[model samples]
Target: MKKYILKPGRHQFAPSSPAVHINDTLTDTEAKWYLQRFPHIAKLFIPLPTEGEVSTAKKSKMKSNQTEMEQTSAFAPPSGGKAGQ
Candidate 1:
C-alpha cells in the first residue's frame, strides 16, 4: 500500500512541514473520491511520489494560483478556512 502525506493548506508550499496520512493503497478512483468531499482543502495535500523529483515538480505546477480570485468562480469551495484570508 502506498502512503500519502496530507499537509494542511497553510503549509502547502513547505515540503518538510508536518502532515497527516492516508496510508492505504490509494488508487486513482479512491483518491478522487476522498478529494471530491473537499476539493479546495484536498488541493493542498502533496502526494509523495515513489519516483523522481520531476513528478513532484509536475504536481506543484498543476496547482492553480490562488491570488487571482477574479479568475475563479465565487462559489468555489473554501480552502478549509476563510478562503486564504
Candidate 2:
C-alpha cells in the first residue's frame, strides 16, 4: 500500500479511531477515507511518491532542464566582438 503524510494538525479518522497528529504516516486506504469524510480539508493529505516514481520524476526534470539550457545557449549572441564592427 502507498503511504501519505498528514499535514500539521490533529485529525480523527473515525469516532472510534484515535486522533492523528502532524507528520503521521497513513496508509493509502486511510487517506482515501479521510479525504472522503473531510473533502473541505482535502489538502491535508499529501501523497508520498514511491521509489520508482521519485526516480522517474527526477529523470524527467533533469531532461527538461538540459533541454532548456541547450535552447538558451543556441540563441546566445556572439562573444568578444560587436556586431558590424
Candidate 3:
C-alpha cells in the first residue's frame, strides 16, 4: 500500500476515527476513504515521495528557477539609468 504524509495540524478522518496530528502517515486506502468522506481536506493528503524522487524534484525546481532568473536579468535595464531623468 502507498503511503501519504498529512500536512501540519490535527485532523479527524471520521467521527469515530482517532484524530491524527502533523506528519502522520496514512495508507493509500485510508487516505482515499478519508478524502471521500471529508473532501475539504483533500489538500492535506500528500503522496509520500521516495528519496530519489524528492532529490530529482528539488533539482528540477532549482534548474527552473535559475532559467527564470537568467531570462529576467536579460531584460533588466542598465543599472546606471536614473528613473524619469
Stretches of candidate 2 above 4 Å error?
1-4, 7-10, 13-20, 23-44, 81-85
Which residue pairs show collisions in model 2? none
Runs with alpha carbons beyond 4 Å of true place in candidate 1? 1-5, 8-21, 47-85
Alpha-carbon error at 55 in model 3, in Å?
0.7
TM-score of each: 0.25, 0.50, 0.46
Task: Report the candidate with higher lDDT, 1 versus 3.
Answer: 3
Go through the candidates in order and give each one's C-alpha lDDT: 0.51, 0.71, 0.74
Ranking by lDDT: 3, 2, 1
Off by over 4 Å in 3: 1-4, 7-45, 82-85
* Model 1 C-alpha lDDT versus the unseen true structure: 0.51
Q: On residues 36-82, what C-alpha lDDT tens digit does candidate 3 reach at each position?
A: 88887777767567799989999999999999999998877679975
lDDT of 2 by residue, 1-85 (tens): 3466776678765557777634546666767676688675466666577899999999999999999999997777679865566
* Candidate 1 lDDT by residue in tens digits, 1-85: 4344454323322245454334343455655565666465455556655576868776666654553454675756576756546
